[model samples]
Target chain A: MDGHGGRERQLFELGRLVKAGLTQPLGLMRPGGVGRILAVRSGEGDVERGLLEMGFVEGACVEVLHHGFLGRDPLAVRINQAMTVALRRGEANAVLVGPLLNRATDVEPTTDQESRPS
Target chain B: MTAGTLAAEGFRPARIALVGPPNSGKTTLFNTLTGGRQKTANYPGVTVERKSGLLKTPGGHPVEVLDLPGSYSLRARSPDEAITRDVVLGRQARETLPDALVCVTDATNLGQHLRLLLELRQLGRPLILVLNMMDIAQKRGCQISTEALSRQLGIPVVTTVAMRKHGVRDLLGQIDALLNQAPAGDGVTAISDWVEPSPDAIRAHHREVERLLQEAVVREGAPEHLTRQLDRVLLHPVAGPLILLALLFLMFQAVFSWAEAPMDWIDGGMAGLQQWLSAHMEESLLKSLLVDGIVAGVGGVVIFLPQILILFLFILLLEDSGYMTRAAFLMDRLMSAVGLNGRAFIPLLSSFACAIPGIMAARTIAHPLDRLVTILIAPLMTCSARLPVYVLLIAAFVPATTVWGGIGLQGLVMFGLYATGIVGALAVAGVLRLTLLRGDRQPLLMELPSYKWPNPANVLLGLWERAKIFMRRIGTIILSVLVILWFLSTFPAAPEGATEPAIYYSFAGLIGRTLEPLLAPIGFNWQIAIALVPGLAAREVAVAALGTVYALSGDEGAVTEALTTTLAQSWTLATALSLLAWYVFAPQCLATLAAVRRETNSWRWAAFMFVYLMTLAYLAAFVTYRVALALGGG
Candidate 1:
């Protein structure tokens, strides 16, 4: 929080400051890393809505399961510990990931635990 | 409540619709419910499949069930989704609205499936919730309370394992109960007024769904270990592509080796029938038409059925095992390099079976230009219809020898022809992206469902469906085309004292001679010129037409000889090779152009497809003929 002014925190602090860029795009996360979805920005068409509809909402937990063979462009990400979706880096750019509020193991599916919105 | 309130006690509904998100096991449940008693039709004005079945309830009441296309939401983006949206809203022409809706959800992956369930609930129709695949969910140590789910949604809920036929009877009984409890006019609400929900509205809906899930479902996240373990190797960058190519190689090899016995039996049967007809009937036009035109023409195409069914069997198995999407994931990088994403790969792969459905499958691509480009190049996938023509040419021309360390030469030639089609498709796509239909690439986003074992019953049913479609094509279009060709070759007999065969003085010969000059440079004789005319109707008919044309040309008893042997003795190596090259890029069957027109909603693109393919065909044939002649192959 060096340059940032006093402001309320989001869901969880950037999931332990990642190496290679502080706040990374969901697409950039390597496999086995967990991050909290901070925001999903809109692109040309229904890019934003499509991401949100697929469970990439704010405060959701996401883990990268695997990356495609070539160029590692498309990544398979497990979201909310419930559904696994594959998306290209371009589409994953709409989802911004910050530090995980809790440890990766603490992440459970939305149905198993209740973390009601304030 | 409007008019049937007095009669609501025992009133029953007439029609019901089953709808759900893709991979929700919706189709499987439908298949189990209908038990092969379903019929497939096209929605009026569109090619989307309209599947309907008759379900007779235990109470002796007959209910018509319609299986709508799988969709994620009512906010439609593609033609498939649009059809689902239109029918549910009672706005589609020639489609009657169902009185009730049965929504299916995958119990194992209810996280996203429930969101779709929430969307369908907004329509205010008489709805029931089907929690399918409960067996796998239970295996993963999950518990879903159907009663609580029913209470939360104010709808009846049923759990089922549709795969092994468990809990289906209760679901059927539940449907019967719903029909009787509903009043005649109960479900007819203002469902037609639905519109696309805003992003904020959808987010709110998701929150509501999360709340509902917490109350009715309870379990720790049971990740699919099988999927994770398999993907480790299957998607292992290097091993992934190797396995994919190896699988493709095995498929092509099996198609050749496994089909020999069945093909021979069909061949022998055709020959015996021809001999019997010629021996019993007098030498007249009727006998000639039956033995020469009908039997020979239809027989040539029927021998390829074993090969076609083998090709479809591999496709069905891959799709069922959830490997198709993984293959698409592997293809994304190359596809994106050509201004397309991996989303277009599935349709292009499906094109290898037939281009009509492949073009129709392109609706999933949200970008209009990408969809158009995918549809245009789909015909280059070398569909099964072209197998007859390719096998005929190779059998007649190429020697039955091995190459490259024990690989069969004929199979190698067949493999080369398929490769040519693929290379031509990629080159055309690159050129189109550079010239026309240019647009920003839409990133691929697709669901990779959990891997499941391929159900044997489903695979068998799929194979049966494909076999029927192939036979129907021959019985209808191929038979009609041959009959016309026979009449043209028969009438206006040779003048007295003429030394040539009678067919030489007929209408078909005159027409073939007229077109011979244009095709002569490509090594196509007058006989091939005749076959090429009706070949436009269907690619397989080219082989059948050749069988008919040559049967009438040779001396008596020549019609009984196999077409393959007849062709081998008459055509040169250069001519055979040139024709194979022509087919690799030649114009597709007429139905393919019609499909392109319907999908693109314009004739300009269809005409463009015809012209470009014809140009490529002529150029390819010309070069092959010249090169083979120079190599001293004649």
Candidate 2:
């Protein structure tokens, strides 16, 4: 797909997931996004390869720690309790993710989403 | 792989490679095992640091330990990783295939490290798994069964703290046992057995690592939360940058303020020694050489050693405490705007002290373009070597009047010089990145390791290494240039009693007079021309050269004080300002060029650096001089 079309398709898929409890592209998640990676999409060179080697694979939990001070173009993320990796938002877009697992309750919410639990 | 095959070959030291992911205490373990007996070289054509050390086993068998660059897997991306993979697989022509591999795994982050170990295991080398940072893991309430881990992986497992003295004895003992068992100089499998791991193969390797961890490693819960809490504040968008700025300010302040006493002592000592030598030794070439040549020139550069150490102390501490990566994270956005990597921050910062270590430090930056761009721009930072020239010029010309908030004008101008360096570096990096280094978007998938108290031993070792490297430069490059400058200033017997001091008739004087016309537009006199020649050895040597030139020209009093006053009285304000501008943009040191050559593995880049910097220096000085002259300062 073309860039804009692919983005639209991802958003559509994210909407479908919100309705029917499934994974979505990580780029669709908001700033405080936290979820387990479904899969890392192919393309790009060192960034993709480095992410894979850093354990950003299927079933690995990822959390967007924070964004850059200015443009917020790059984001810091923690992967699988192993490491915190910083990447551009465009680079983070490759990792497809599922919904965040509710920690205390061990439940996956299927409906309305919140940025963080109070 | 049989032990019986190696027993007949006699006691050739067994070669062992220490491999691990970055920040996994691999280096600390290497230091612990090797003590102070480590040597660093480059891996053939690549600039990746090849570190090796000698160790004697309990059985008196000598072992050669090589610390390969920290890497995640054999699927190499960066030059560093490729060197590691090549060395491990015996594909490197200059390196021997290791008799054994010591896979250093961070106990706190085994899930990420075990994959590398599993991949190494497939190579069929004798492997000893080192569970480094075990103390941290235990403190976090994680339990690991070494026996079970060993049984599962079919390799000996050893736990090590790596920082404390006794922490690595068990590891050493285990390594000795493995060595004795393997016999001496047993050859490993051929490089042809290595396969390019497919995505599926890597995924399977990850799965196998997960399975191994599940069977042997246990924890009460998930990862520690302390780091996350700390990051909430330390990595905060606004607070993070502020803290970094504050830390940098504090570091610069310490470098200048704390080094004053020691600098004074060194100055006084050198002057006293020079005076005593002049009094005792009858007027001869040896006395002149000892006093003016050695003491004045080398002593000038050596006095800044304390300041260099102070700067490196902070850098080493930040690196050891795991905050360097977070600093990189904080810097990524700003760096990426200039088409550089976040990892380039530390090396560029190190350039403020000196460019050699800074260029060496650039090895940590993975991308060749980013690393080269960083190396090219590193010399642009206002290194401590330039501090002397800046201080001397500012003191001579810029006023000491205090401005807003009691900040002295001299201090403000010094800060401006440093700021100019930053601006120049940024501008050059922007242009170079656009034109020369243009390529794919430089990715920064940097791993910010967990924060820990900076280990004192590791910090000391790092500082010691820095100190040794600095002193080595002083002894070789600075010393040679100083001797040559002394000879240039002294030769031809002063034309047999020619008035206007001895140097006026010497070869150096002639060269200076000839160069004076080219430099005159920038307001530089023949003496300034003389200083600029030797100044190429090092930026600070300009101060020393100026001192020697004035002394040879029959100026009275101590070199520094007399030179400052003489410069203020003799040269136009335009000249001083122009010289300051020159130092700011010039490739102030030939050592920096040599470092650039070594790091980039090409004299072409070094030549390009020299030409570009010289051009920038000339243009900047011309502009500054013309503006100052036009403003009626001449």
Candidate 3:
């Protein structure tokens, strides 16, 4: 799972939208960046099992949707095109995602104007 | 395989289990298949719901169907999920091994659902895969080849829209086919090859699911654009919480406003029936039992049905609309700060209507400690039962004058009483979380289901189920308690010539006076003491008990008004305030205690709850009485 960390470090060294691996807290991500999951290591109990069951798996694409208003503790992340999982930053920290591909065409736009009916 | 062949072999109902991931439309399909002929109970000792229905085949053979609680895998983490695993593997002694399994999966999210299907397939049962919610999937432009999927998995596949009438017939036909063909192997023997799911095994299952989806399912446009658009507002940092609050406010307001006429209808109807019976029947124990005991006691409870239905309607809508998860997401931060899981929010909120269903709902929380704390604090919410008492006291004592831009003072006091209950629950949960039940906080990792309009038929079915449960409680526990209370208050017959009404000389009054010294510190007289005894059966019984006590004193000029006026003339302001404070902490409801005992699977926790709540009630009442006296309200 840490394989993505080294690759992410190289991208970070190149000084682009890339930062640390998805294993880092979701709070560390740029608000609109898109990434693919490398692993989900969120402890060993129902919590991790539930997260995995909800599609937090390797090779599935994920994008940080937004943070909650209070303390920004829980971060909403959209996985695949079918599910949105609301997770705490602490929980999201264990779910590893690869470095961002691009912001424009990858992540679903956070603004309602794009998805709203014209 | 025809019915005649089965009859020749001596037919028995084939037990088919409906298993699925949550939100996969399992219950809808079950309801459609069974057509409201379902029976629900608890799994013997545990509180996990057991729902089974008899489905009649087209040829008149019966198929017994059990709706197992939704689970992600055979690997069990929660008690609810454990029941599913045990029953499926035939490990439960009391449960019959299912002859076949109907593994339901979501048509929209086959990736996750297929993993569980694959896991169940290895159990070697005669399994039929159902791709439910086909209409929604097709609307989202996803195409699934059911035949190809069936061929790959070696099981019959059925496509269903669950909510529509015609969509379930194909699934029923498929079930018929599976049951007609005797299952391939003895299901119990296959357990030997079954491996417990491990983290690595799970990842492998996911890999296989991905590979399978690649060949069997195809998608067109954006899959969740509608969900995202709605969540952009419903889950907005500012707008989300605001909308949730508005919805809750509207719900409470509707509970009071919308149900007024129906409640009045029930009340008037019961009153007229009681009067006609009393006049027509001879003056005997049977008449008294029918009139005062059954009519007054149970009738008071039955009147609240309209409000209960309304409250449950809103709950059903919120659940069916798929916004419950979003509400959980919205409340996660606030709830975790007080040591509760976000999922506990709905159960605790439900407690505001009634604690029995609220505690039952707590089973959905996976973590044991969180579930325990949620159950412990649930009774602290001011249920609709408390409303009668609050309204009575507020109307009789607090002025009805408008204040703060036209809000009635009575309304303000009602709101204050509700706020006090919430504050008390939060304090107790925080204290318990820090002390006896202290543990690490569980992570909030919940799925937000795709939004959909609340299905009316599904909502109505859910409400009907709730109504049945409520009526069952009334028929059994509440009825028996009321009968016993009547005997205590009615017997030893009012000493033919005695002055102060019959109840004064009866067993109940004697017991009340005997217990008065213990209660006097809280400023309660023997009348209040008498009412408190039967209030143990249910908190709202206190109101009826007071009415009975007053009426027996020969002041029965229309029970409700007379009781209120008498209380105002007799009790001091300090006493009334103290009584309200006492009720705020009262562990008096026997039904809640019974539910707690059942849910926790121990008499010890139930006893612990009773003791702690009684002590709190006493202390709070004592302090309130003293403070009220000091403030010159005496």
Candidate 4:
């Protein structure tokens, strides 16, 4: 959805891990870092389905918002800005990701709003 | 399709069910629809709650609405989900199939919520898709084309902010029309034709929802702005835990300090009633029973209500504000280290208030092993019932002086007891996870709901319901048990006034004497033995039993004043500390045991819990007594 079509997709795939070496597990993303989910590295269980059912589908945007204190075991990831999911680093390891297509959030200073409900 | 046409036709659905994914605001919507009229009980043979309430449409047509447990799909995984599935599929014998289904979805998370809607659609019931939390979605600048989405799904859909308490006018009319038109939804019960969706089917459904989302929903603005900003600090590594600790410390301190005045009022009121009764009536058995048994016994238990409310107030606020999940997030590492799911934190924390609700809350934990482990250790969480016992013993034995600047020594002991409960639970959970019920740890996959100011109405309503439940327990169970206790201790009065209290010759006295030898190793006398017997009815009842026992023995003062002095004068410091240690591990509450039984769906687990807890209690008391005696406190 970066407004580029198959040509750009092909170019990115060609560069793959070299240019987009940032690709890693969602659990390893730094705070405020953005990533596009490629797939969940599922094993033998419903973890894959559970994550998918929670909207970790392909091409979904995810950002690591916060990490737990000790060893940063559990990380809170904002999925597509629609839902915030808290999963431990082990479970979050299932989510494979690469650099986001859109770098708007990085370029544009974040907007703030006083939306706190009383 | 208007409300008038449905009313004119006298067509009203007999029952309606609210179905949704977890955290879809389904319960809030149910509250909006049913108002304050609701009954919550267990489904047959399961721990899942069956909440039904009566609601009338704008056209004045009555409908029975059920608030089902939130589920991701009809293919049930947990007991809670099983109930939702069975009831919807007309497989639950105790519950008839809902006449029409109200499928609720969170508009903000339509990308995910719609997948469940798509699955529910396959069931072929008359469904009205409700997009709840529309206000939040709108605030986040999500543009959802309701008409297009409705047309695409071939179902009626409406947007609602259920928290607003509005009639959800669009939904009200839609329900009226759908129910009127599809009066025979019951006849569409074709359970066998529905096969459980494989993972591939789930993926296909997800694709379908993605397609629908692309076509009908447009996203804009900095998504989840407030939540992201708040989490930056609240979920920070160091400061987050410190804040959680501070909040918990403040909550416990408030439970003692804030409740003092109210507890005093109730104590004085009960004492006044007892005094008045004694002054007016003759010195007869009937008069004695009225004052000592009823007033003193019930007053001892009721005095702790303020403390219970204070504890629950903090819990309710944290729950409604959605910080509880974050706490679980932070605690997940430690929990998993001790072999528990992060979701166990909610139930375990609530266990400090009472174990019954804690055990019931475990149903939300999908893994049976995690849920069982959570339930088994729930009673060790120093519930509010134990507060009266701890407070009474501390006030009588421990100094009331402050430990540091404004930190009370007594409050420190109370905090220590709470800490002890948590440690005990964690240790036991570790051992259980390793020894019996060993399995792969449940993954941490909980939704961290957006931070919002807790809805005051919901918080207050929840507090009131708990308060009512507490008072009902006192009014019925404690009152009746005390009456029976009084009779047992009063009848067969000491023969020929053998120079001791009349209770010494009573049936209760004989039983206490018989059990004294068994408890003697732990420094428990006959009176403590007698109290421990009836205390099994409820932990708080032990406080009442102590009050009733000594008050009947003669010249013992009233509950709040007299029982403290009486126990202080008689029990050695070793015995007092030993008793406190006993309560910390004792599974004295029958209600908690019954809850564990029902939740585990077996007497075996309950019996195991009882045996382990009793063993721990006895060992704890023995060690405390010996150590205190060796230290010359005895």
B524: Cα error in model 1, Å: 2.7
lDDT of 1 at B329: 84
Model 3: per-residue Cα lDDT over B54-80, one tens digit each? 877775557889999998788875789
Error of 4 at B606 (Å): 1.9
| DockQ of every candidate structure | 0.37, 0.32, 0.36, 0.35
How do the residues A40-101 of candidate 1 rate in per-residue lDDT, one tens digit apiece? 77755488777877788876788887888778878988887667788998889778887676
Off by over 4 Å in 2: A1-24, A101-118, B1-10, B41-47, B165-167, B183-190, B220-222, B551-557
Query: Per-residue lDDT for A41 in model 1?
Result: 70
Tell me the lDDT of candidate 4. Answer: 0.80
Who is ahead in TM-score, 1 or 3? 3
The reply for model 4, stretches above 4 Å from the true place, is A1-22, A101-118, B1-13, B165-167, B218-221, B279-290, B400-408, B547-569
Which candidate, 2 or 4, has the higher lDDT? 2
Give model 1's TM-score for chain A to 2 decimal places. 0.69
Provide TM-scores for the models: 0.89, 0.92, 0.93, 0.90
lDDT of 4 at B304: 74
Indicate the residue-level lDDT of B224 in model 4: 67
- Candidate 4 lDDT, B12-85, residue by residue in tens: 43678999998888888888888889887768788676888987777566678899999888877788898888
Docking level for model 3 = acceptable
Worst 10 residues of 1 chain B by lDDT: B1-10
Candidate 4 Cα deviation (angstroms), residue B240 = 0.6
Top DockQ model: 1
Give one digit per residue, the lDDT tens place, for model 1 in B173-228.
Answer: 88777767765465553365787877766777777877887788755436567787
lDDT of 2 by residue, B215-236 (tens): 7875522466678778888888
